[model samples]
Structures are given as C-alpha cells and as structure tokens.
Target: MTRENRRGALASLVRTLAVALVLLLPAPAVLADRAPIAPAPSAAGVLGATTYPLSLVDDDGRAVTIAKEPRRIVSAAPSTTEIVFAVGLGDRVVGVTDFCDYPEAAQSLPKIGGFKPNLEAIIGAQPDVVLAVRGFPAEIIANLEVMKIPVVILNPVDFTGVLANVERVGDIGNAHDAANTLVTSLRQRWDAVEAKAKGAAGRPRVLFEIDASYPGSIMAAGPGTFIDAMLKAVGADNAVAPVAGGMQYPSVSDEAVLGLAPEMVILGDAPYGQSVEALAARPGWDVVPAVRDGRVVTLSQREVDVTSRPGPRIVDGLEAVAQVVRPELFGPSDTSR
Candidate 1:
C-alpha cells in the first residue's frame, strides 16, 4: 500500500501490456507473404467475334467474299488443305488432293487426285469454297470459278505470307477466334526461334536437295524460295543462292552442286531411301563439308511436304530444319523417322 511499491507495480504492468501487444502484431512485410498471389491463367482457349460477313483478297489479287459461314470447303492443294485444317475448319473440309496428308484426318478425306484434280469429284463434294495454290494449273482455277464455287488462291512465298494465308483461311471459314489464337501461337514460336538464332554461330552454307534420289538428276531450292528464306531466318545460308538465277526452284547438275560445296546438305527426298550415310557415299561428294562434318540430314516425308509449302504447318517444318542446322541452339523435335 506504500506509494513507491504502487508506482513500481504500475510500471511493471505497463511493460507487460507492451510485450502482449508486440506478440499480437504481425511481422513486418507479413502481408507480402500472406496476400493470395493470383496465378497466371493458361493460354488454353480463344473467343471469336460475334459478327460475320468478312471479305478479303486471295493470293491471286482477286476480291473474295465470305457471304455466310462456309459449311463445306474443298482444299485443292496440300498447302491449301493444311491451312484450312489449321484454322479449325477440319470438320468443314469435304475433299482434298492425293498429296494432302498431314493431320491424318486429311488422309481419310475424298481425294481430287494430284496436279490436275478431278473437277467432277470436286463438284460432287459440293463445297462452299475451293482453296487452291498458285501452281494448281490456271485451267483448274478457271474451271472452279466457272462452276460458281468461290476459289481462293493461297500461294505464300515466305513466312509472312504463310501467316497471312492462315488468317485468310480462318476469315473464309468464319473461324476468326481460332485463327487469331493460331497466329498468336505461331508468331510466338517463330519469335522464340529467331531470338535463339541471333546468338547462334555464323551462318553455314546449306544445299537443299528437293529430291533425295540423284542419279544425275537434281532439283534444288534457290533464291526467293521458302527453304531459302527459312534457312536465312534460322541463321543458315542457302548455297544455291550463287546459281539461283531468279528461280525459286532450279535444276542443277552434279557439277553445279559440286561447285557450291555447301557446308550442309538437307535432303528433301524422305520418300526415297535417302539417309545421311547414303548422301555421304555419293560419287565425288567426299570433299563436301556436309559429308566431312556429318551434317547430311533428312526430314520425314510429311515434314518435307509441309515445310516446303507455305502453310500453317510450315512452322513445324522450320522446327525440323532448325534442329538439323543448329541442334545446339534448337533441340530436335524428332530425330528418327
């Protein structure tokens, strides 16, 4: 009951209260650790626009119109067939050419034959639109036009053209959402490849044989060709550039090929029994850098057909080439057949 004792007791009580308050309070920056961190959503899907009546120009400089959604589409070329399916119109594809074989589903479609398609079969399919490439005989395109079936020519000369064709296919098929999504994905992949390619070693001179078998016969990819552009994009130079002569595909003799002395050789003859071992054993190819460096490579037949063509699957082809050219930078998607 003394004054000093009472003052001492009050000070002790204040200290105890301060200690309890400190225990109840959170640690510094505790909110930073406890606040629910929202995770990023996966890029799983895309939403399409609600409107329709999209019009565009085809590769042949013709003003094409998509009045209503295309219920049935006939792809007259392999590249054309690929772009059609890539834009999410697989179900709408009623007919395809004998050469159109990638999505496996295309192999099951009704065939219109190769080079010059069976017009009767195409008409029988009764497609709302017919997609063709620039090389599909002018007569075939004209015949389709005469039939009153909308024919859109898709001949992509390069990577950009390939993307444009993909979007155009979607526009014609009325699958804008799917097209946009696909384009975004493709661009992302290509950008990634380009970024990695910038840091790759100096460009290697490459010889791209269009056909694998060569008993004194040769067709190689030249300047302004898709393979040339793709090789350049991935930090490889096309050896055919020296003898290209303004031809996208030029027939070269064995002497011409020997003259180029390409640092690498990519055989487009997957359909044939061509292999690195076989290419290395060719007559007078012993001194070639491709044989010396063991850089002779071949892609699957499907990959060769797709990558060579300017279409949505072209990126996949790029993947295969990049793997062969600079496997250190871009890993192989598949090494075996």
Candidate 2:
C-alpha cells in the first residue's frame, strides 16, 4: 500500500482497538467525569521543579526513568505533538510524525515518518525522550528501548484522562507549570460547557458519523468512543449507543439509522466530501429528523482534527460539540479558533 493508504489503515485499526484496550484494563480514578484534581497550595512550592532521574509509569504500565530534563523531544503521534507544544516544549521537539501538522510550527519540523515510524529517522533526531501513544508497534518500542531511548506512551481514555496526560507530559519535559495552567484552562472550559448543557431542555439523540464512504453502512462513534463522551458531556445522547452492542465504532445501515431517528447528525467525514446537501438528497432520508430539520453539523478538516484527536485541543472539540448540540446555550459553531 502507498503511504497514505497505510496511514489510513493504521488509523482505522487503532480506532477499533482503542476502546477494547480500555475495556480490558481497570478504569483509573482519573477517568472520572470530574475535572483533574488541583494540586494543594502546599505543593505549589515545588510544582515547577521535577527531580532528575525521575522514575515514572506510562499509560501502558511501562516503567521509564528520565536521566535528566529532556532538551530534545520527539513525538510519535499528533496528539503527543500537540501536548508537547502546549506544555511549552515545542522548541525542544526535534522530530514529529508526518501526521503532526498542527500549531503551524510543527509543520516545519522534520518528519519522522508516520503510523509505523522510521526508526533511523527517530534515532537521527537524537531525542532524549520520545512521546508516543498506544497502537505504536511494540517491536519498534522494544528496539528504541534497546537503544536506550526513553519512550513514554500516553493513552487517555476520556477527557479527564486527557488532562492528566497533559500534566504527565509536563512532568516529562519539566514544564509542569505550563501543563498545570493548560489543564486548568481546559477544565474551566469543560465545566462551563457542562454547566450550560445542564440548563438545556433535554438531551437530544445525536448521530456522529465517522465515515460515509460506504453509504450502505455508515460508520459512527459508539458507546465507548471519545465522540460519544463528547456528546454526553454536551447534553446529547448518542443515537448509536443503544444499538452498538458494546462496539466502539459501529457500522449502521440506512434502515437502522432511520429507525433510530436521530435529532441531529454530526458529519465527521465532512472533510472527505460528505455534506448536508448530499445527505438530504439520499432517498428516504428526508424522514430523518436531522435531515428534515437541517440540524446536521458538518465539521471542517481542522475541526475534525481537533475533535478526533485526544490532545490538548480536545476541549476545543468539546466546545464545538456543545455549540452543535445546544446552540441556544453555547451559541453558533466557531471553527476559526
């Protein structure tokens, strides 16, 4: 397969496996619906300082020790890249995957390959530490470890976990102050959305379409996916949740979707040429509430990136979803930000 095709396949595989992995593992307290716990005032004196030879554990439960504050960092995933930059470690980033194209400056960085990363390119970056995520090849991680490269895997299952991962990245980079501030702002934004959502009349059933390439069987975010969590957080029920049968990303047929009668539809595949007009043009789709009422929300490529990624910008995704689900409360969708 070509590079693009390979990356696409890898992304699909990752999405399919992510929620399964979460299900097999014991849920962490940090994954609770509440915001990340704030550090006590007494801990403030040392919050900015990270002791050297730091021993830590990643989401994958691998033990890693940082010999010193890493001056050169490499990101293996777009989410990690965004977290590294958000934590004030962008300058230290020497390499990133081909998919890491956000924050503008990241686009100028040396590409370290994508999906299956180039080991040589990673080594060439001379990184003190590499920030990775789940679904990264285990053999590659083993090779990097044998080469004495510290690879920290960050896999957050929910919004709360996302905030915790931000702090974890900050700890790795010795930019705890910046990470804490970013998490605080994210939590505040999340709380505001939650508050607004609570005042809404009722939770509407929303269909979050992931892919419409196979129009006969539209792929959608199911019960355990981040999109489902986002809809829940924004006072909306997932139309697919009731029929997903525990599948994270389920494929639904036109008849099934029609039966569900979703109040709104979020086209995550809008960047791939799926549009409201095209959806409305479909035969027998006129009966769907979203199609009939013009309640379908189409996401731009940038908006899709922000919403799909479980990174620092996820709160931006939450706000966007809130706007779509409860426009009367959160106002119109603003993708420019």
State which candidate has the highest TM-score.
2
Question: What's the lDDT of the predicted structure labeled candidate 1?
Answer: 0.67
Q: What RMSD does model 2 have?
A: 8.3
Q: Which segments of model 1 are wrong by more than 4 Å?
A: 1-55, 212-217, 270-273, 332-337
Give the count of colliding residue pairs in each prediction: 1, 0
Residue pairs with clashing backbones, model 1: 212-269
Q: In candidate 2, which residue ranges exceed 4 Å CA deviation?
A: 1-47, 333-337
- Candidate 1 lDDT over 1-337, as tens digits, reads 7634543332222111111101122111110111211211221233554245656788789877655667888998767776777766787889998867656788999998875689889889998888887656677667777876778888666788888887777667667777777788878877887788989989899988764344754567778866777798799999988887886666677777788889988776444455566666777787887777666765544445545666666676676677778777766322332
What is the TM-score of each predicted model, taking all chains together? 0.78, 0.86
All models: lDDT? 0.67, 0.76
Summarize candidate 2's per-residue lDDT along 120-154 as a digit string, tens digits. 99999999999988878898889889988899999
